[model samples]
Target: MDNVNQAEFWQQRYETGSIQWDMGQVSPPLKAYIDQLPASAKDQAILVPGAGNAYEVGYLHEQGFTNVTLVDFAPAPIDAFAERYPDFPAAHLICADFFNLSPEQHQFDWVLEQTFFCAINPSRRDEYVEQMAALLKPQGKLVGLLFNVDFGRDEPPFGGTKDEYQQRFEQCFDIEMMEASYNSHPARQGSELFIKLQAK
Candidate 1:
C-alpha cells in the first residue's frame, strides 16, 4: 500500500478507538523480563515501534529507563500517549513509519515489540526483519511477544507459525529465545511466544 493509505488505515483505527490490541497495560511476561534486567541497562537506547498507546514505554519510563523511544505512524494514539504522559520527552515520541527510521541517525541498543508485527501487511515481513536489523546496533536485541496462532483476520493482528517466523528471522538474528511465554496475560495465554533475538 502507499504511504498515505497505510497511514490512514492505522489512523482510522485509532480515530475510532477500535484498537483491541491495546493491552491497556504492559504484558506480564515483558514486565517480568524488565524487572530482571541489570540497572546499568537503564541508559541503553531502546525503541518500541508501532507503539500504540505505548503502555510498555510508559512502564519503562516509570522504571527509570533514560533513553526510551516510541514510534508509531498514527497520530491519534501518539497524541493520546503524549497527553497521558506529558512528562515524556517530546523528541522521543517519534511519529513516523518504522521502515523509514534510520540507524545512522537513530541507532538503538534494543527494540521492544509488542503486537506491531502482526499488525503489518504480511508481504512486508521480510522488509520488517531487514529494517529491524539495520536499525539496531551490532549485537542489539529485539525482545518482545509474537502471536503463535492465526487470528483468522483479514486486517490487523495477522498471525503465523513458529517455523515461518524462525525461517524469516534466522538469516539476520541469533534466535536466543522464542517460546510460549510462561506468564502471558490471561487473554493471550498459550497463543503468545516471547522472542529474544540478537542481531547477527
Candidate 2:
C-alpha cells in the first residue's frame, strides 16, 4: 500500500515543511470561484478533504461561510489553522483520513478538491472517485484544479492526463467543466485544468 494513505507520513511532511504544493494562500482560480458565490451559498455544507494548510477553508470562513468542514490527514496544519482562526468551529476541523469519513454522518452540498486527488496513491484513484460520490448530497458538486501534465515520479502530486481524469471522474460525476485553466497562477499557467462536476 502507498504510504500517502497514512496520517503519520503526512504529519512528518508537515513537520519538516516539505509541502511544495502549498501556495501559502488560496489557489487563484478557486478564489475567483468563491468570489462569485451568492449569499445563499453561505449556508451550504462544504467539505475540503486533504486540506493541508486549509487556505481555502480560511477564505470561505472569512467570507462568512458558516458550514465549512476541513479535513486533513496531518494534525500539524490543522493545529496551525485552528490557531489562526480561533472562532472556526472546532468540530468542523477534523484530523482524519478522508476515505474513512462516514457518508451517513458527513454529507455535504459540495466538495473542494484542491491538491488532494494528486497526493493520494495512484492505485486508489477509483476509490477516491467512489468516496467523493458517497460523501456528497445528490447533485453535490466537486470543484477544483488538477494537474494536466504528468510529473513522472512516484510520490505526492503525481499527475495525469485529461483523458485518464475524464474516464475516472465520469464514473460517478457529471462533468460540467474540465478544460485548461485560462487564469491559473503564474507557476501553474500551462499545467492545470479547472474541473467542476456534479455527483450523478
Candidate 3:
C-alpha cells in the first residue's frame, strides 16, 4: 500500500488481478463528455495518464480521435491494452511514469482523469497538480471524475472532498465546474464529482 510511487506495485497488482479500480469499460460520465466534444477537437492532443485498461483511449480511437495518448507506468495493463486494440497506434501507448513526463517534450490540449488522481499517494497531490499544469497548454482543460467523499483508508484509491480538491487545484487551474455527477456509474453514483478545470 505504501508503494504507490513504484511501478512494481501496480504491475504486480495487474498481474495478480488486484485492480479493483478497473471499471472494465469506458466510464459512463467520460463517455458522455466525449460524445459532446466538437468534431474540431478530434485532433487535439489528448493525454490519459494512469490509464489502466485504457477504455477511454479505446473509446476515443473508436470515435475517430487520431491523436490520443495513454500513459501508465505498469506494463501489464499497457501490454494487455495493446492486445485488446491491436490496430491502435503503437507510438501513442507510452509506458512511463506520469510525473516524469517532460513538459518540454509533451504538452496537451486536455488531459482526462479517471481514477488516476486518487490512486497516487496523497502527499504527491501537489506534485500532481504542478505536473498537470506544466503538461497542459495554456487554458488547456483537465476533465474527469474525482471522489467527493473520503474513503478513510491507507491504500490506493485515496479519496478527498470537494473543498480539498478546490484548494489543491485552484492554484493552477480555473475551476470551470466541480459538482456532483448526475451520470456516474451506478456504483459510484452520488459519490463522484465531475470536474472541468482549465489551466491558468
* Residues 1-200 of candidate 3: C-alpha lDDT, one tens digit per residue: 66999999999999999988878889999999999999999999999999999999999999999999999999998999899899999999999999999999999999999999999999999999999999999999999999987899899789999999999999999999999999999889999999999999
Q: Across residues 119-175, which tens digit of lDDT does each residue of candidate 2 receive?
A: 999999999999999999999999999999898988878899999999999999999
Lowest-lDDT window of 10 residues in candidate 3?
Answer: 148-157
Among the numbered candidates, top lDDT falls to: 3
Candidate 3: C-alpha RMSD to true structure equals 0.7
1 or 2: which has the higher TM-score?
A: 2
Output the TM-score of candidate 3. 0.98
Count of backbone clashes, every candidate in sequence: 0, 0, 0
Model-by-model lDDT, in order? 0.91, 0.94, 0.96
Q: Can you give the TM-score per candidate against the true fold?
A: 0.96, 0.98, 0.98
